[model samples]
Target: MSSDFEPILMRNVGVAKAADLQVYEARGGYQGIRKALQMSPEELIDEVKKANLRGRGGAGFPAGMKWSFLPKERKVTYLCVNADESEPPTFNNRVLMESDPHQLLEGIMIAGYATRATVAYIYMRGEFTEPFHILQRALNQAYAAGYFGKKILGSDFSMECYIHRGAGAYVCGEETGLIESLEGKRGWPRIKPPFPAVAGLFAKPTVVNNVETLCCLPHIVLRGAAWFTAIGPQGSFGPKLFCVSGPVNRPGCFEESMNITVKDLIYGSKFAQGMIGNKAVKGVFPGGLSMGVLTGDELEMRMDFDSPRKFGLLGLGTAALVVFNEDTDIRDVLLNVTRFYAMESCGQCTQCREGTGWMYKIAQRISLGAGRREDLDILVETTRNMGMMPGLSICGLPDGAAFPIRTLVEKFRAEFEQHIVRQEPGKVERVLRVLN
Candidate 1:
């Protein structure tokens, strides 16, 4: 499963004293910014655009395209680094921050220069106590070396970086929500039309990028766009850091090209290796928990930004895979997932607040053996009517809630029906036929 491709973002991860500034500099760290300093802001943006680097956050929007959204002439453009890696089991960001904090800082410097942002803020999750301290130490090292303050690396472009710890709200992972929390307000997502690119972080033009996305900047700056696009399939460019959890022999983050299939990821020698005790995989949340589930039979799909759409998932969300074994109960998984979304909702949108709660309640009843045959239908219908797809919620939290519950119920309909307790004689038969 090991390809000829070398690690870019993760090159310095396992080295001794990897987080040290001298170690990073010795490995050609600040060269990207040095090269970037010579280029105009337009050139920097164009270079990233040519690389086809998409945001590694849930959305997978093109990073360069996002940077280009800023107004042509803004006096105070801000770059908000989304370090709030709140997605469940998605600690690749935390790893990057802790293991290679300098890489992240260099990326921020490059991106800030590209966007002409005078200030950059790393919005960290409150739970990232260790990473926050490690990154703060690294920031101090960078500032002392003149890489963060004015005239970085002896260049005219100057940007200041700061770490803003959040209250660990899952909603703050959203760009607008992060901005709201940064501005000392509740972490509720603002509606679009005045999108973050136009008005963000105190009503100024802003660009919010995820930790992993920024980490790719230094590599793209040094390697060129053609080098990145050559690694993975078209539109799924660059080397990707994948977080694989659950009952796997090697359950942790691994970096590889996007050419790897979901099957390869689970069973590949260089990746997760195989399931624990050789147990059969019942299902996998190939992306994050919210991106929906892939039945065991669906493991042939590739792990890419585009592949999941064909299989009815939300998208390649954080590229974090959580696998479950055959002995596990899909109903319980749904209940747990629904309960999380229901609790994490910002309560800004009626659909998300009410829909997630109702879904969780129905899932709870199903898990508790009190489920009605019609409960399954109600869950599916509720998901369909809520979220951005139905234009019902302010943010995509409802959409996130909908994907897993809907996919689990739709794909594992029989399992859900079997849990209905056979309260009525003909009810189980009717439930089985609902999909037919």
Candidate 2:
């Protein structure tokens, strides 16, 4: 995997005053919006459709198709920029919002025009207090520069932009859930059928796109769909920001194409720069805590929307890699992931509300040496009983909860069983030592 690729989104991240409007302009900022304002909104949407830019916010949905879902007869259209990057071990959106606020705003403006939206709200997570301030200043700058207010860039199209800080609820990352929070209510996911495009934020036709998804718009408009599609394979095009953390030697965000493999990310000098301590790798949580772990042998799996499925892992979720060395315990890994999904459930659906807690406690018992042989059976079967099936829960929270535990228990069943295997006291002691 050797090629020359430049960073598009993060090109200005390291420059001093990069967050400043002048610095971003010196680097060719807002050129897309200028071009976009000259073209019809349908033209912008068609370019995105041709580019095949999928949503970077875990779901991998097509951006253009999502925008097209809006009804043609709606009175008002809204664009909610989902800056709530609450997924564990994922913070790439914060860098975009804090370092290059105008770029995000430009994307918003481009998307606003495409969706025929009159207002845009940036639903930033409360934990992103600093980014919030940075984005607010950028919004002010953009408005003062005639880039965000009425007749943006001297065009007839105008869209208002604002930011609302969420109380750091993970559920708000879901589009409709973020919509509810924006309406000054609890961040609970709304049932679909009147999907966001049909009925969203304040019951207006709304489009909820992730911060990264919107950030790509400026580039798509300026560089054209041909340039965008040339970056990666069909269906998974464009630059991706991967946040590699958890015991890596160089834990930082690296921008790369979607074609990069997990092995390359962990070992490539331009990426994580290999694992810390030179220890053997036991397992890897390839994408934050939602997409389940990939065993050390599965490192060769391609980092894309479809490749991970061959290994019983969910799609490249948030592209946040949490690596664990061979010294780590499998039971402990399951416990931590199970506990996260459990704590984050919004308690909207009965099955998700209770099943998440059940899964967490079961994994905890396994980690604490209180698990029995039947507990493994209980764990596997419990996943099915949960309301993780589509339409059961208000959103994908339950499925997000069930998928990781189901895959973890199923894939690592043998290793999990060894913890409860009681041969002789001496044998169990030796096993524990080897595991540790």
Local distance difference test, each candidate: 0.89, 0.85
Candidate 1 residue lDDT tens string, 341-389: 9999999988889988888877776676567768889998999998888
User: How does each model score on TM-score?
Assistant: 0.96, 0.95
Number of the top lDDT candidate: 1
What is the per-residue lDDT of model 2 for residues 411-433, given as tens digits with 9 covering 90 to 100? 77888878878423454344445
lDDT of 1: 0.89
Collision count of model 2:
0
Q: Which portions of model 1 show Cα errors greater than 4 Å?
A: 421-436
Candidate 2 least-lDDT 10 residues: 423-432
Candidate 1 colliding pairs: none
lDDT measured at residue 331 in model 2 versus the true structure, 0 to 100: 88
